[model samples]
Target: LHGKKINNHTANEAINHGFALVTEERRSTGIYAYLVIGFNSLISNIRNYKNKVGLLDNSRMKSDTQWVIDSMRVKTPGHRTQIGSLSGGNQQKVIIGRWLLTQPEILMPGSYTPLRA
Candidate 1:
């Protein structure tokens, strides 16, 4: 952060420093790809894509994904399903789980209002 605005240019840095965002646009390309790939590969990519660091091995990846699924109560057949196929709430849960994996310092969720009964 350091007083700089969080835009595309600063987003990566913010993420590295544990900043995350969840927007109403949950069906974005990245989220869709993440759903297709499943959590293990997603965590692997998150670790290696930007910094070429391997934070979690296969065992750890599975463990972490399970944790997320359990915590979010995401009722699905493991992490193999296309997240897009899930209901919107489940999809949001997956996205939230993904951001939570980042261990962010600040989490900004946008335009998420619960339905009124």
Candidate 2:
């Protein structure tokens, strides 16, 4: 959390400092499969979408979600599509996109089988 110690803060609060993690058991922990891709894409950084009066900035959320879809090359019909409909790899892309949207200073992705790169 930059130079600040984050010992007492809640997990969500820690996100404000641009730190995120993608866990090992992605199927169990990473995604809300029944939810739309748009929802999943923005959930991590959802608080940032609020307006001064606390209304959601839907257009911005959509735009960012689209950015994630396009940039990550996540093969989905659209943002409204359910995440469960996608293959495991594409789902992982969406999960990664969610954290990338936060412009994270540090990202820790857990033990997924490493790809040949």
Candidate 3:
């Protein structure tokens, strides 16, 4: 990994080549729109489309999302429940699934420390 801070171009290149990172803040409440936005929307957000036709591949998106969910064991209401509503463990799983959707060759997850009651 590069020692210096990564710029947008480097970050984009890394993502395209299957590099992903998961922060310790697992809730990621704002990204709870996974159900409504759909997996394809999320994937396409990182892609640079040459034309409009390349952007509307709904079937592929559905399958991709399903695969990630299954692989990550992220249980949800399938487009109904907000991801933020899930428990901490489930939310972490969802985050992992989201990164897996990118098909990363390398994944960097931040250290996890449970809160002490």
Local distance difference test, each candidate? 0.65, 0.87, 0.58
What is the Cα root-mean-square deviation between model 3 and the actual structure? 5.3
Worst 10 residues of 3 by lDDT: 36-45
Better of 2 and 3 by TM-score: 2
Clashes by residue pair, model 2: none
lDDT of 3 at 30: 25
Per-residue lDDT for 27 in model 3? 48
lDDT, residue 39, model 1: 57
Residue pairs whose backbone atoms clash in candidate 1: none
Positional deviation of residue 114's Cα in model 3 after best superposition, in angstroms: 11
Model 2 lDDT tens row, 36-67: 99999999989899999999999999999999
TM-score of each: 0.72, 0.88, 0.65
Question: Of the candidates shown, which would achieve the greatest TM-score relative to the real structure?
Answer: 2
For residues 13-116, write the lDDT of model 1, one tens digit per residue: 77887787877787663366435426522541256433336444666567667777777777678777777677777777767777788877788887774622
